[model samples]
Target chain A: MRIIVPIKQVPETTNVKMDPVTGTMVREGVEAIINPLDLYAIEAAAQLKEKFGSKIVTISMGPAKAEEALREAIAMGCDEAILLTDKAFAGADTWATSYTLAQAIRRIGEFDLILCGERATDGDTGQVGPGIAAWLDLPFATYVSKIESIQDGEIIVERMVENGYEMLSMPMPCLLTVVKEINYPRLPSLKGKIAAKQKQVAYWGTAEIGAQPNNIGLKGSPTRVVKIATPQVARFGKIVQPKDEHELNRALDELIDMLKQKAIL
Target chain B: MEYKGVWILGEQDEGRIKLVTLELLKRGRALADKRNVPLTAILLGEKIDAESLKKLGHYGADQVIVVEHPVLRYYLPEPYLNVCKVLIEKHHPEIMIASATTTGRSLMPALAVKCATGLTADCTELDIEEETGNLIQTRPAIGGNILATIKTPVHRPQMATVRPHSNKPLEPDPQRQAQIIYEKVDENLLGSRVKRIGFKANPAETASIQEADVVVAGGKGFKKAENFKMVHQLANLLNGAVGASRDAVDLGWAPYAAQVGLSGKTVSPKFYLAIGISGSVQHLAGIKTAEMIAAINNDPEAQIFQVTDFGIVADLFEVAPLLIEKLRNHLPDKEA
Candidate 1:
């Protein structure tokens, strides 16, 4: 089996600052790291390679710095990597973004599976994975937590739904967006690190991937942001901590009193 | 079709309407009424009852567009998207709101891409701009670190997936009337690339967390997976549903259904007990509607304490057992 894992580079900051006027992320000098969820995708692919003698390939679409994420995936056990970077790829919505990835996958030739994180933390849209599946015309599943079984021509997996988990069986040449619960990622090996440094990532752009000019990036994206601003937190509760054992008991008594006054207990 | 009315995606489970669908309708009603446009509800399923259609009318839908077919019995992303594409193209609704449940979370994005429109996911707040008549979608970004308000100026139908429990459902009024419009699904277009193997539901209504009036949640402070048993024991004692933070869910301490966060479930219980959750902003966003919040954690600086009405600084391993014992004593009739 052969697999393609899509990874994304996001800002390391949890409180990512946004441009107050434009409503876009202020990405001038923020340090970037692989999206936390994509690690699970890489780990899932690596485990398959170890168990089934499959080859692992990772693809990332971003600025030049995104190659760092691809190399990190390689270090974690992928066989090859592709970096889809170009100025035209900037400001791409999930539609144009997934379309670009679909074109890249077509360029990469045949693969049994394409893996992606359930969503990206930065954009936080789970759209691209399914969008890619739509464009490539493949069976796809999202928020998958476990691969119950996998073999020639088919795979059965557990996907998280609204109420409970659903066991799904689908044929190969399918795309899966894995959840973080799928597996714990392994640290890069010494040999893997050296190999990752030496491996060259195939860089593909709009022209190389045969992506249509009209459906490439900002030009292709239909959604335009009108504004962005910080939201107001509505709660006005008192936040406090007890000082000692005496205060602890007093606090508990006060809580019980409040609950009683409100007739909650 | 002038892209006028507000449309609510009516999501259902086993022929019953989901709460998120009702919540979306209420929000849709306000937006539609503000813009002085009729509100529409789109329903796709094999069978939909007249009572269900009436329910939509009572909830403020002026029209209900339904596409019933055998292939639409269960949700298949491809087929669902196709149905949405047909309705969206034909009606050209000015705004479409969907519940951020599993089905809508998947369906809306796919449909939005196909329609070349903008979709805001897991929105905590939604409104219409008075001047431009654009949709104002606000949601937490960066794993719920901060909330961001986004607007779509260039799109025809502004779409958003509202978090469940973020809005209250309007009281039903039998006097309200809505025209039920039936549509036929093209069987060929309804064919899905993904084949269903089977759908096995654990069947616990509270498992979704939306139905739980009281939720006992745990997080990374539990330290290990086995410690989650304490959290469940506490919930069981209180007769409340068990929930978890994303960390606990990802670490295998709790099932994904029990997760409470932006990417997970949004819950607003009457009483929420955070056993060990340190509280990420994403986790806090899910519980903002809880009438009262009580948190127990070892770290003093944990953000969970900020929103909690009652804060106890101690290890969950210790506090959980004590609370369970005290609660058990207080309510001897409490079910375990």
Candidate 2:
């Protein structure tokens, strides 16, 4: 069996800052890490590899620096790594990103399963996973909480539902977008880190993947960030400070009256 | 044109339809009505048991497309997507609406790609342009610090997935009726990918924080996981659910399921009790839709107070017990 995990490099949420003037995320000095959710996908892939004698390949589509994310996935026990980086890929939305990824996956050839995080934190779109599955014309599942069993060309798993969970099984060559509840990700070992440092990561650009220029980047993206601006903060009411019991009672009464006036009580 | 209507993907689990599907139908029907087009609902399930297709008409559907297949009893992305894709290709609708549930979230993106169109996910608001008949999709951006309105002007079938509970489901009209279109299942496709092995429903008693009417949410101010028990107790007493700020979840004081923020579940319960949470834009985005919001914190200047309908300037540790005690005494037994 072969498992492919698609990972993403995202600006660390804690260090992420917005440029007030430009209304864009300040990324110049922010540290980039493998998207936290993608770690689960990598882990799930590694577990499958361990159990089924499968190979785990980590793929990422981002800037050149995104090689670091692939390296980290290698350190986490991925057998191979591929980085899809090119100037043309910049500013791509989920659709473009998924298209590029689908081409990359096709280039990688045979894979029994494709795994992805439910959504990337930066985009919070959760579209790429299913989008890839769609492009590949494969069966896919999202918000997968647990994998019960996989054998004989079929994969069985638990899908998280609003009220409860349901068991689902799909044939091989399926895509799965996992949630955090699936499994706890493992830390990189010393041996794994050393091996990752020595491993060469493959790089693929749009031309290498045979993708048309019109469908591989910002120009291909149908949706655009027409405008980005901070939402206006609503004005809050004045704070009432009460000095004595009488004043406290009056403030409480006034508050209730206001609630009544608004018909919120 | 083979297809002359708008279609809604109705999501159902455990014999009950999801609320968001109804909400989407309500909005879809309105869109169809505005365009002077038929509103159709696509119901895919196995042994659906009930005559729920009529409910679609009650909520304003001109037709209900029913696909009953045992293979679809449980959601296997392959078969479900295949069925829908075939249906869509055969009958191309002008617009498609789906709930942003786990299934819909999984299916719509893939379906959109198959159709070679664009999709806006987790949209808070959606409307059709009166002149151009394009979808105006509105959603939060930059961790909810910004709101973006997107449009897919060139797409053939405009598609948008809306968050659950964001919009109200229309009231059912028993007198309404619609044509029920039945589609035969392709046995070969159904037998292809995905097989149903077993099903385990989550214990309902576990209580999903997303459904809580009153959420006792804690934040970094809680200091430790042990302190979260107070929140749990209060939630238990109130028959609500426990929630946590992203800070608390990141601090490992709570599980991700209990988190309320941009990355977590967006909840709009009737009453939200935020304990010691200093509201960030992301956190506020998840809870701003609540009907009533109350905040308790030691810091009087906390941002939570700004959006809260009621603010209590007191230490959560102290105020929480007092509020719980007061509610126990003042409220009815069921509420308590």
Tell me what fraction of the real C-alpha contacts between chains A and B each candidate also makes.
0.44, 0.46
Query: Each candidate: RMSD to true structure?
Result: 3.7, 3.6
Interface RMSD to the true structure, each candidate = 4.0, 3.6
Docking class of 2: acceptable
Let me know the DockQ for model 2.
0.42
Off by over 4 Å in 1: A13-30, A232-236, A240-265, B203-206, B220-230, B246-252, B262-266, B285-291, B314-322, B329-332
* DockQ of each candidate, alpha-carbon based: 0.42, 0.42
**Tens digit of lDDT per residue, candidate 2, span B131-230?**
9787788877656656778777676577778877666778988888888888896677675465555665545433576655567788988888898787
Candidate 2, clashing residue pairs? A169-B194, A169-B195, A170-B194, A171-B194
- The alpha-carbon lDDT assigned to residue A202 of candidate 1 equals 92
Work out candidate 2's RMSD over C-alphas: 3.6
Chain B TM-score for candidate 2: 0.91
Q: What lDDT score is found at residue A78 in candidate 2?
A: 95
Instruction: Compute the lDDT for candidate 2.
Output: 0.77
* Candidate 2 stretches greater than 4 Å from native: A14-29, A48-54, A150-154, A190-196, A233-265, B1-4, B49-51, B173-176, B223-227, B236-239, B247-255
For each candidate, what is chain B's TM-score? 0.89, 0.91
